[model samples]
Target: MSVQAPRWRAMRVSDLPAASAVAARVHPGYPEDDAVMAERLRLCPEGCLALAGPGDLPFGYAVGHPWRSGSVPDLDTLVGALPVPAGAWCIHDVALLPEARGHGAAGEVVGLMLGEAARRGLPEAVLVAVGDAAGFWQRHGFRPVPIAAPAGYGAGATVMVRSLAP
Candidate 1:
């Protein structure tokens, strides 16, 4: 059977359940805590986007916000370690449902996020990637920063950055 390309758009309050469901399916082992996800859904509604197939069933999603150094310890520390420009975007998380893997959904999501960052006049974007996804982010122009440990992602995560047109 052939899978259809999912329709992607900015997420809304109504999309919370569907987005959460997709997130759960995508990151089963590291399921986002409900409270944190709820806050993200509430505060940065436009920062969240969803990819859905027929019937609007979510197949993937990407969530991010203006990288506020004060809000994240590791990110703040990482920022201190680098000589980045004044303003940069930070991507908190991006995930695709298992069924949607290998279909370039993640790239689409990243593209959208980067486009948004560009639209906001940000010059660069950063993210902490987990698992074997380091190579994936690399393909999107993200380069790893030499750090002892991933700041916001914890443990062995790798921190990556991509420059966007200012």
Candidate 2:
């Protein structure tokens, strides 16, 4: 019999550690610290998502919030607060374990985020594609932007943006 896929759900206060585990596994260098992840959840729990498997740990996690598009948030640090009139939806972190890769799960999670952006009346979505993952974001309709990535994100880190469908 074929195995079932994990289900996507809103990230809650209880999922912090599991989410951190997944982030640490997928993003070893640019670790999104537990405190930073919690801050993102606080900024917009509705935008943060977790893929729950049969076990306690999450299969993947996508954390984000609406923020000003002119700048990117620091790597692995706390964003004290989102701007009062955030202009675009910023995808802060997305991580998936090996078993969760090459599946439709990531795309589905991004769809949920885009839907949230549209619902919030945000015109755009932005993210810093690390390493060679720019192609993945490009496939999702995000094009490279001139915005500079913050220090510690590595040399290949580049900002990308796309308009959300209203």
Candidate 3:
């Protein structure tokens, strides 16, 4: 059976469980830990978005948080190593279940998140991509920052950024 296109919208508190489940399916490591996800949701509820189809079951989710000074020191180190400005909203995580995979749901989710950032007057959005997903984010206009992964997040995770127009 074919999966229907997911409807993208701002995530609500009730969406947490489904969102977390999709995240587990997609991110499976590092940030997928329960505590981390809960903390992220608690910190920036508005930055989170969910994608659901006709029946309302979540297919994917994207969450981000304000990149306040020293918010995530490891991220700070990597961004600091770059020649670009050190401040940008961090996209904490984004994930889509296998059934939702090739339907452009990811782009819609990210677009909504970046749209929110732009509306807030932020100039850019950043993320740490794992696995083979770096290319996916790259396709969405995120360019890799020339810095190695910081402590605790592990290697091979590329940090990327995409400018959001003011």
Q: Which candidate ranks first by lDDT, i.e. highest?
A: 2
Worst-scoring 10-residue span by lDDT in model 2: 69-78
Runs of candidate 3 exceeding 4 Å displacement: 1-4, 68-86
TM-score of each: 0.79, 0.94, 0.79
On a 0 to 100 scale, what is the lDDT of residue 96 in model 3? 78
Clashing pairs in 1: 74-151
- lDDT (CA) for every model shown? 0.69, 0.85, 0.70
Error of 1 at 73 (Å): 6.0
Across 50-150, the per-residue lDDT of candidate 1 in tens digits comes to 78876777777787766643222243222323224426667877877777777778877888888878877777888777778899999999988874444
Local accuracy of candidate 3 as per-residue lDDT tens digits, 1-166? 9856678777777888887777666766654445555566666678777787768877887777667422333531222222233356778777778877787778777877887777767778887787788998999998888766556567788878788764
Once model 3 is optimally superposed onto the true structure by TM-score, how far is the C-alpha of residue 51 displaced, in angstroms?
1.3
The alpha-carbon RMSD values of the candidates against the true structure, listed in the order shown, are 5.1, 1.5, 5.3
Give the higher-lDDT candidate: 1 or 3.
Answer: 3
Which structure is stronger by TM-score: 1 or 2? Answer: 2
Expressed as tens digits, the lDDT of each residue in 56-145 for candidate 2 is 458889987989965678788877888879889998878889988887888988888888888889889999999788998999999998
User: Residue 67 lDDT in model 2?
Assistant: 91
